[model samples]
Target chain A: MHRMMSDKRTIFLMMAPGFAVFFAIVFIPVFVSLFYSFTDWDGISAYRMVGLHNYRELLLHDPVFWKALRNAFLLGGAFLLIQHPLAVATAMILQYCGRAEKALRTILFIPSIISGFVTSKMWVQILSTQFGLLNRLLDAVGLSTWRQDWLGSSSWAIASIIFVAMWQGFGYAFLLYYTGVKGIPQDLHEAARLDGATAWQLNTRIVLPLLQPVIRTSIILAFIAAFKQMDTVYLMTQGGPDNSTQFLATYLYQKAFSINLYGYANAISVLFIIVCLLVTAALNRMGRQEVGEF
Target chain B: MARANPAMNRKSPLGWPFGIVMAAFAAIQLFPLLWLVDYSLLKSSQFFGASILIWPKPAQWANYRIAFTAGHIPRYLTNSLVVAAVTIFLTVLLSMMTAYVLTRMKWRLSSFFYTLLVVGLIIPLHATLLPNFFIFKQFHLLDSYGALILPYVAFGLPFCTLIFCGFLQTVPRALEEAAVLDGLSVPGILVRIMLPITRPAIATVSVFSFLSSWNEFIMALTYVRSELYKTLPFSLLQFTGQYSSNYAAQAAVMTVIAIPSVVVYLLFTDQITSSISHGSVKG
Candidate 1:
């Protein structure tokens, strides 16, 4: 049996197809991207090696890169500060809603499952300056003064993007928290109740503390999602209104496809990957340290 | 369950507020799609009316017909379905085989290979886009379904393999040992026994792969230029250009694009949600 299981030929045959595709399609491209990042390829002309020049320009000279970086961080921060807390609070409330729990959870998760294209298109209509549902509703409610071009104006584009993104993503965040809340052993809630702890105390003092691991994971996932945001931004604004809503992925795309600066785009992608890894690593370290304390 | 938490009991003072809050949030979550559907049934002129929502006295279902014919939705939808179906099939099959080899077989570099594959979860797809474009261009695969399908399957494998590996580890070795004693070959055991056991994981992987591939926009946008190979999401971009002022028709196109994913989610909600939590937490 052991021999059969460990037969080198069979094992090799089983692994070869997946490994070949993965390497050809994903693994090799990553290395190729890294290689391209050091050159000055303009997609049309013969490329010349210019070691460190692309990164140097991207790091020190590019204001748009800085803005995209800042905007990505802002999106990440909003996910952590705004979206996560609301999701948690909603999850906490839903946990106590006896029969309606599953239905509500399903409804909340619907947004996350739909295509980003659909979400962006829907929001674009809702936020349109002339025929927007939002502004129209605001007028009906006598708040017409508050109307603004949600996706067109520079001041509101990023915030609108963030809002649409948060709306689209709220379901997944809510689901994570809901599952975490459900996974909390019933005894914890019972024990707290027996000790005469108020519901608020039971959640804050007991439930929240026990939810540390899920919270850490959720935060990490949120940051990854935020940094990786491109589809919605691309569909809605394409980082328009003079690049007001630029994200890392969209900016890299614009540089590569639109402007034909393949080398600089590759440099941006490499840094993008590094930024994601660093953020994930930092959060993981913090999580481990906190776990050590307990 | 209701008796387990008195606060959640219907008779409790907090019940009404909790129900209201949950209902309100559910409404907020669902209203946008409902409104989209509503507007899709209205005439284009009615879209700018004073009311935020108008019940179409007579529904403009023609918008859907126009979207289907004029918007080139059938071609895009066919492309999307073919790409997604092929991607899901290949990803599930390859990942299952790879998972079995990595977990059940004793090999010197199994752990190394497993780590390498699992690390793909963090590598953003943007990093691969440019290189992949050139690679596809070299192979003359641009404007072909293979261009989208290959990368989709490649990116889908890591997560699917991870899920399958997690599932495979939990299956006891006794069943496989029994199969071996019954004179079953390794491939037979894998096919007849392991595949049956991993159905839940397969469902999870299929849904994940389908969602990723079916709604994939950037790769399709980059690799496929001709309308012949464009996927469903591309229809919206084209509709935005072609029917730029036809708001109702555009809404119809958007609705059509969103329906398949919504249907899949409805069918596999439990598997999808559970797999997401399991996959991400473990990942």
Candidate 2:
């Protein structure tokens, strides 16, 4: 018994630094953020407790916040409605593409392997107004009138950002679906074929149903990514052109660093945390219930 | 073994369309990178005068030299290396220890601690940004490597630990028991038994943690103030701002920033994919 107790103590000691650092860096600060949200403390100021004022303003009065939230939703919707289907189709195609599968898979995953900063910068260069390839291509095709300042124009900015994000993230979705498709037993497909199912029926009935869990995981991953998106958005536009391209993360950052509204930023972050937790819980719950049904 | 259908073994008649589509998407994926490299060799005059689609005629590789000197890429590169290396080492060590305890130790709160660590994965990184910045300021650690290293390790731990835990669970219990019976200490078993068995897991975690620390931007931007302390990504951003009109120099700087990551990814492509797939499949 004494030996067991000593071992337990050792285990605790072993875990101390990891947990300490985790708490100091992540846990304590998250709570501190929650506490700061209720006050009007700039980073330097001796602030008053402005009790829910920040949240009130953010939730009810802030149009930019609404815009950020809407853009996030739109980005998430695009991932689901656009990127997911395309990834699934590509995965299925690659599965049937015989010798080209390995080469094509690697090609598709190129964007994902590069850093977000590099990819974002590359897109920024591609979208540059004066000497960008995109505009040059448009001009070459005699569609120069169709070219607008992609990153600068308000109407085009959000869409441009979305396109860049989708491009970068497409590889991840493709790989996931590819792995899922590869995992489906060959016998199942063979059995379905012997039952005289067409290729379309084989996909719809056997393959896709098995791929639902992967689809779910990808959607959740993409949604969280959209919600927490800051790097590409910050690098590309910094929520610019009259805040038309604002996102939750970038807005919080601008509030804290650019505008020095630390308290308001903290409020936004707390709300951000709550939204993330709720989304995660809701999605996992849905997964659980679906598994139960299965 | 079940045989795949003979028809399935052959390329489809529609393979051309599929191949063409995939190739087009591949081109889109790779075009910007190609452009970045192509333009990096152009002189300033050529950059301004030439069509964006045109290749460099007289390749002025001196642009890279100017980028290195003017952008101070070597210093930023060193800083990034130090930060990434330290964070990878520390995160892997700590995560292994935590995973060891969670998996092998007979603690009552093992599951609780496991949940605590795993929950870290879902917490939005931005939520911790301001508070950590404030805390670093309080500690007077701002503008130093510690500021970035601390958060990098902290944020990295959850994912690394989870990966280690998943891998550790598959390790046979008998090996650990045998090591203990041989009068090996807990640390001894971790070093001698656990470490070797979990090498692939370590590699996966190391690659990911290294990549995250190396490629991370927002934290580096928030924490570092001095040019001396700035990482490669932050330096590149600054370089762009400073040389916005010098597209060739900017492209050269970007290429310098990009090459290391691209090289690492190419070298560890299989490991990276396996690790990602492993995480998703297990989840």
Candidate 3:
């Protein structure tokens, strides 16, 4: 009892600021967004209660919401399938590389460290229709017909953007997998070789299984990144060409700030949170099986 | 798994070709950056020089001169510098306080506080978009450094606190207990005993907070409207104009904006790289 009194006071003092800032800024915003989702506020006008009306419209009436959600899913799916594998492959190759390893790692990591704005601008120049490098290169290679306005065309815009994102992000995911792969003992690989396993066989039966945790972590992170991505998207397309590349983050901004429909944006945010939660939970369930040991 | 004979030791089949392929990939990866340097160094006349090798004939070191010719960049760089400095100071302070208290205190609610910090991880920026707009407006802090700086500290505190808390967990408690027994006071123990032991964590937190605040764009875009109050990203975004559509100058602005993050990233790659690669995800 004597010890408890002083301990309680000190602990309270310690935990106060963290909880205070977080509860006020983060948690409060979450709940307020929920509350605002039911209103008819245009962000600057007097509010009116339209309980469940925004949600109703969003669930049944809105196509863009679904489209944005699907875009996020496409982004997430690409990260998991393409980016994650390439990150793993890059990291694995670098890890197996004997000399000049640090140089290679540093070189690979430069793109990740630069501002996304710079990379997006670079890609816009590269993928643009008239004077793009890709088109120029294609013309030089006698494959000029293969050239297209990657960012201008609606069909290819989202995919091209995803490709740029993956290209820039491959280093990060590669670093993650590289770190995890480096953690696995060299003895295990040698033992597998002693057991007469070929290179491909060892990778399939050993390295991949051991890397399940890393892979899951990579997928979850990549998915979350895909969902909240704004910087590159902001600069690259600005959710443009008739909202073809619009996402939840950008859409929320469009509704609340650009279009002045704060209440509806709040609804989108509420739903956005729910969808992210569901996706994360679903992934956790899928990744729940044991990451096997050597 | 067969440790192939080291490439240097054997002239294996396709060794040179494989080496060439990997080198080509590296070249492809670095080509755009090289192009960035190339463009930044070119005159408007020679800027679009046809040959990649022969381009940038006379390197215009003056592009850097033209970039800072009285605009938001200087102000933006200063604002970002102040914001980053203030953010690191306040966040590291708050993290130390929160981490120490949570670790040392004997309250039922300390665990809850720790959990709240964790949830801060999953709180997406979009979730807070509308509410914070209302918030800063009510506070009358729109387009001010206060508005930008305060939210940044709030966002960053959780991340640094997480690391500090984790670091605190690994620290032996006897030193803290000794300080307490010596009646040095709660604050004194943190300053005197805890801080010394947690130097690496603080260094990690400082580097991270500075880089993140310096690089962050979404909040700055949402909250900061006035060009006067804009940070580096904001400045770079609005650098391009309707008249000239100055791509070369914009590249210069991009270089200016890229400097602090790139320099800091390279300087503290060991810390930032390890921390980020540790997979403790935050915005």
Candidate 4:
């Protein structure tokens, strides 16, 4: 058994195919992107090496890059501050609900499963000015003054995009927290109850502490997702209303495809990876102090 | 079962409020889908009506017909299925083999390869877009199904491998040892013994691969230029462009495109949800 398991030939055969594909498609392209970031290649003509010129411009000159970076951070902050707490609370509420838990859980996760294109288009229609459901509903409720062009006006565009993104993403967050909440041993709850702890105290003191790891994981995932936000922004707004909703990925895509600034886009891609890694590393370091060892 | 908490077993005083809150959230989550189906049946003129939801006195099923024929739904749907099916098969097979080698086999560089593959989980897809485009163009793979399938399979490998490694860790090694005692070779044991045991993981990997490749838009948009190989989601973009004023038909297109994902999710909700928590927590 040892001989067969350790056969170098067998290991080589098993590992080679996946490694080849990963290297060619994913791994090598990252380096190639890094290489192209230095050259002023426009996808067709010969180019000269710029040597950190694109990076300098991106950092010091590009207003859109700054705005995109800020927007990405804003989205990440919203996820951590707004979406997560609400998700945890909802997961706790569902924990005690006897029979309706599964149905509600299923319903909540429907949005996450559907395509982003569908959700973005649906939200666009709902947020439309003239025939939009939101405006009609607001008027029906006698709050006609409340309605605005949700995606048209620059003021509301980013907020609308955030709201749509939150709606689309809330289900997965809820599920993660739900899994964490369910993993808490019922005995812990029982013990807390016996100790004369109120329900609120049971949640705040016991459940929240135990959910630290899950909270950390969710936050990191949210940050990575925020940096990776492209499809919805592209489909919904296309960084419109004077680029109010430009995300890093969408901007890189526009620079590459639309403007044909392949070199600059590659630079953006490199920076994109750096931002994701930095944020992930920082969060992981912060979470290194172990909590909830039970 | 009897020892289950009394508060959980019966309706606590807070149950009503909690249920209402959960129900409202579910409604919020589900309303857009319902509104979508509602509007897909209405005429284009009725879209601008006063009511938010105007029940079609007579449903306009022609919207679906137009979308199916004019939007090239069948062709795009077939292309998407081909891409998704091939991607899922290759991703599952390759990742399973990689996971087996990483977990079961002894090697000098096992941990090295493990870290190398797992680091891919955090590499954003945007980093590879331009370089991959140039690579495919050089290889003459642009505008072909291979353009999409290769990348999808590559991206799917890291996550699927992580899930498989996690599952394979929990399986008792005695199964493999016993199989070895039966004169089975390593590949034989992996095929007959390990494959069947990893059915749950396979289900998880398949669902995830299907979701990503099926709804994939950006890569498909960039890689495949021809209409023959365009996927389902791309058809929505084209339909919206071609018939910009036809709101109902566009809604119909979206509804049709969303059906497969919805069905897959409903079918594998347990596997999908469990694998998400397992993969994220461990990874």
Candidate 5:
């Protein structure tokens, strides 16, 4: 027993595989990215240290970087202002939905379950300038004047992207809020009802207050998701119509793979890491505030 | 408006509004997918001319055949399956082992290592992109299964480990004590006693990692350049790019790529919801 207790080798053996793989794939590469960010390593070239030159250029000179950041913030705001509230309300309504709850939840979540590629391509077709479903529906409803290029035009591009992103994410948010709502003790609602609490009052005061933790979680996740937004935008428009819908991920990919600007891309990546970590830390700090007395 | 009524009537008046909202959202949710399926069976001309609400008169089943044969969807499907299966196996095993150590063992660096693992969760994959590309290129692993599987396993480790660690902590210490009395080693105890009990956590992690890897795009797109090695998402993206004008074939490819994931979701809907909510709340 003593020998077994003292055996460090087994513990090391157990930790070795996961740590090695994680280090090689995730950890070491990030530091390598940091190092490369300070150099001019363009795929094939033997490069010398540029030492923050890439960072300076990306921060000071790049209009597209600011555009991407702005779009990401817009999407994040939509998640908070539009998606989360809608998800919570739907989840609340779903509780009262009785028999159709499971089916409705499943239907709402289906978009989330499908691949981004399929969703983006399908939306592209549905947003076709001439024969899109949105346009055709408008025509059918005698609102043909509203029909326009949804994904093609610069004006509607970001909103269209946000709508698709929100659609894809709606299910997960609903499920999260639904699960949170379900976790609330039933007797509280019963007691509230017995005390003459109205439905709106019950939800706002009792259920929603109890769901603050879940809401915080959903907000943080939605923000990070918006920040990391790439796949749908890449497939749908490739940040097109003059980079109108550019995102950090897509822009980084374009800079690296498309144009062979590995050093410049790495610099963008360093900022990307900083932004993600700061957002996460900030949210965590904010969530550390007063715990509800309930 | 009295809240003192029986539960049925108290909720009954608002039922219509809730039902209407749910039905409307469900319709909105389903419209794009239904349109995709509808458009997958039509020629481009037919697709452009047909009413958006209407189905094709004569469905073009050949699109499926063409997508499968000419578009190399079967190849992509097989590649996705292989990569996802292997990645799931490795991720679950590695996560279980790591979690077992972190929770059950008395290692000095456990917290530090655990923090390290958690950092993987927050590090944007885009940040890792160029370095991974360079490393893989150096190792001559580009356009290969290794490139995909390694990154998949690595990125998947954090969340899976978190889930497994949460589950492992709940396992009664008495079981391990009994195993120790019977001369079982730590690994043996993990294999014999812990693995069986952690089945649900394993299932959750497997489902999540599998789905993510199957639907993964950026890594597959950046690392793999060969048509022979592309996964479903990458293949679909490439096929759509090549045939941007052929809406039917693009839709067909999308449908073929989408079925596996949707079927997986249907099969594991309970696991997905339960596991994710469990992680979020506990996390």
Candidate 6:
């Protein structure tokens, strides 16, 4: 009992630094932001408590918050539906095709591996209206009319941002899926084959069922990326074209720092946390349960 | 059994199809990177009109220099390097110590401590922006390296410690018990006995820490206000930092910023994917 008590003290001593910073820097600030949300203060000045006015303002009046949340939803849905499915398809191919597995994985992973800021800037140059290579290619293909000011036009700006984001981050999902695939025991497939199950049937019945945990994680990660996306949007659009491409994170940033609506920004953040948690929980329940080796 | 009769059997599920598909995929993947390299050589007119997919006419490698100087890449590169290096050092140090204690010392509060670290990951960093900006301003750390490094370490430690702890869980407790019996103190047991065993986890942690520090831009832009501390990626906004429309200079500066990360990624490519698995798959 004495030994155990002393060991517990040692453990407490060890965990002190991590939680000290975690609480002060992350947790305290987050909860304090909740408090700040009820008050009106520019971040620079000492704040005055306003008693739920910020929340009221955000809920009742702020169109930008809704737009940002709406854009986040679109991105989340698009990634889960379009990007994640494509990632699974690619990962499935790479996994099944043994010879090309390594090489294909590396190739498909290049975009994700590139620095986000660099990739965003690269695409911006690619899609530039004048002196842009994408437009030039369109002109060459005789589809000149297909081009628009991609980042500059409100109609297409959000989609353009989402597309670039998908391109840059698809590698994460791909890698996750690959790991999931490789983790499955070969005996399962061998037994299925011996049982006279055709390859397609084996894949559908076995492979898909096995990769559930990975798919769940991918959904959670992809959804988080879609919401917390800051670097790409900041570099590409700065939430421009009249704020068409703003995500919740960037929008929160614009509110707190750029616009100096500290109270309102904190309000947005309180709600943002709730939304992220709910979405992640939703994906967890929706995604396949991982198989345990035990 | 799996390898012995390959020639006689002549029918393994593995085949050349993977090779062909991977090669084609590799080409597509390398194309854009190659385009950037090629574009640096040509003048603006030739570059812009040419498909970003196609090779350059002359391949003027000197464009890298033109772009570098135009972008003021030296300052941004230096700032990013300093920030990345400092943060990496601090993150590894803090997480290593915390993880060592948590894993090595079996205590009742350890699980609670571990859960506390998750606050960094799940709290939505956006919420902290205002608070941090305010705090940094209060301390006069804004527009300085300290501003970025401190917060970075805070955010970085939880994930890294978690990774190290995950890897540590697999290690049997026998080694430390044996070390304790051999008259080593707790700290000595950790530094000499346990740490050496977790080199792979350390390698994994290093990859993420370094990359996260290198790729961070929003913080760099927000905290580091001076022209001197501009990060390579953020400075690319003005195409060499002067706000000109010079594509060549922008590309050149990008090469500068991209070089270190590319080298780091190439060197640790194995570690990145593996560590990511270590971080996410277990828990």
**Best TM-score among the predictions, by candidate number:** 4
Docking class of 2: medium
lDDT of 4 by residue, A195-264 (tens): 9998899999999999988888888888788889998899889998899999999999999999999999
Q: All models, DockQ values?
A: 0.67, 0.54, 0.42, 0.67, 0.54, 0.46
Global Cα lDDT for candidate 2: 0.84
Deviating ranges (above 4 Å) for candidate 5 = A1-6, B1-11, B237-244
Top model by lDDT, which number? 4
Q: How well does each candidate superpose onto the true structure, as a TM-score?
A: 0.96, 0.94, 0.91, 0.97, 0.95, 0.91
What TM-score does each prediction get for chain A alone?
0.95, 0.94, 0.93, 0.97, 0.96, 0.91
Task: List where candidate 4 sits over 4 angstroms from the true fold.
Answer: B1-7, B240-242
lDDT-based ranking? 4, 1, 5, 2, 3, 6
lDDT of 5 by residue, B100-216 (tens): 888877767889998887778888887788889989999999989999999999999998898898888777788788889999998898889988999989889999998999888
Cα lDDT tens digits, model 1, B6-95, are 445534677667988889879988998999999899999998789877898799999999888877898888989899999999999999
TM-score of chain B of each: 0.94, 0.91, 0.86, 0.95, 0.92, 0.86
Question: Which residue pairs overlap in candidate 5's backbone?
Answer: none
Supply candidate 2's per-residue lDDT for A109: 84
**Model 2 agreement with the true structure over B16-87: per-residue lDDT tens digits:** 677777778778778788888888888766655537656677887888888887788889999999999999
Error of 6 at B98 (Å): 2.1
| lDDT by residue (tens digit), candidate 5, A148-168 | 889889979888999999999
Clashing pairs in 6: A100-B18, A100-B19, B41-B60, B67-B249, B71-B240
Tell me candidate 4's fraction of native contacts, as a decimal between 0 and 1. 0.70
What TM-score does candidate 2 get on C-alpha atoms?
0.94
Q: Least lDDT summed over 10 consecutive residues: which range in candidate 4 chain B?
A: B1-10
Q: Candidate 5, B195: how far from true, in Å? A: 1.4
lDDT of 6 at A287: 71
Off by over 4 Å in 6: A1-5, A43-47, A96-99, A285-294, B1-26, B50-54, B238-243
